[model samples]
Target: MAQKSFTASVNAFRDKTKAQMRDVFSEAVQDVIETAQQPKARGGRMPVDTGNLRNSLASGLNGSFGAPSAGGYIVTLSQLEIGDIAQFAWTAPYARRMELGFFGTDSLGRTYEQPGNHFVGAAAAQWPQFVAKWAARVK
Candidate 1:
């Protein structure tokens, strides 16, 4: 048998995982926004774990051979102003969940700490992707 290159497979796994994660967070955020925008609703804050995604092959072999994709994006309200949350609070329940906590200041003199009711014990590796997706726009 010809030699196999597992490097490509490994990289593919990582890239796919990252992309999927980005998409998941983007969608979750969108839902939060949508929910908050609805009329006659109290916008609650986003939960630590938003919710669970349906079993799908595209997500992974999770249905039968892979792990189930965890739903929800752990986020903070640092970039969002109170008005923004209020505007979306009508539909999205989590808009009200936003909190202002203090951890420490960064080089830019910004407060960087865990917001209220965020997913705790998240893998460190997922941080960059989560933040990137949270900041990016989703159609």
Candidate 2:
């Protein structure tokens, strides 16, 4: 085959594989959100408040933050590539406080002595399994 033809074929294959990986990653992120949102009986610790925090959970390519979704995070990671980083984020203002614990006064000058649930961390602990499960589904 011509060099140009060979290169084009290889490039197409690479793109397809990358897309598949992105799909796998996206699914894995969705799994994390679902796990974190589960009820306490199911081993999840996040309490359902106004539900904003849960709805705001989103996944993006190398993004540490995202605008809170009006509905809920759709778990779309289309732009991720082989070398790109995938990030899971909660856009709510109190997300970090809830996850990591807050025992002192906040910037808003409110007092809080809440213990940490680390719900997201608990959910993310299974990241390797999630990724493996998603990857196995890729064709």
Candidate 3:
């Protein structure tokens, strides 16, 4: 029987895997940015308008699968400020009051409870789907 070796084939697979992993991470980051930019009510009961907030969303990727050692890639999603003002209204001090509501009632004497926006939670929930998509694409 002729002796056979897979060293060359294994090396090729490793290189392809590394390249595909980078593509997967890049696509994942873009997905996160797009999700964050979606128009949705924020700032709880106050319901901060999307306005410039959606435009402020951005994504960044750091490191790569081919890096030395065991270092891995990192994807970061950020809300950048527009001009000197913060784009996200949730960063304002009054955001908390809007989320938790107040004890006082309006002129009609009818009170109401403010609700939290839950934007962060909602975004986190999509992470699993994003990861699955990445895995499928890489394979």
Give the whole-model CA lDDT for all candidates, comma-separated: 0.37, 0.76, 0.45
How high a TM-score does candidate 3 get?
Answer: 0.48
State TM-scores per candidate. Answer: 0.30, 0.67, 0.48
Residue 112: error of model 3 in Å? 11
How many residue pairs clash in each candidate at the backbone level?
Answer: 12, 0, 0
What is the C-alpha lDDT profile of model 1 across 91-124, one tens digit per residue? 2233222333346785678766656532222222
How high is the lDDT of residue 90 in model 3? Answer: 33
| Candidate 3 lDDT for residue 109 | 89
Per-model root-mean-square deviation over C-alphas = 17.3, 3.7, 11.4
Error of 2 at 135 (Å): 1.2
Which regions of candidate 3 deviate over 4 angstroms? 1-5, 41-50, 58-114
Best by lDDT: 2
- Candidate 2 lDDT by residue in tens digits, 1-139: 6999999999999999988877887789778878887756666788666778777776656655455563245634545556777666777888898889989887889999998888889988999999999899899
Give the winner by lDDT: 1 or 3: 3
lDDT of 3 by residue, 1-139 (tens): 1223577777889888776766665566555534544445542222436343332332222321122111121223222211222112233444445445556676778785656554444554677788679989676
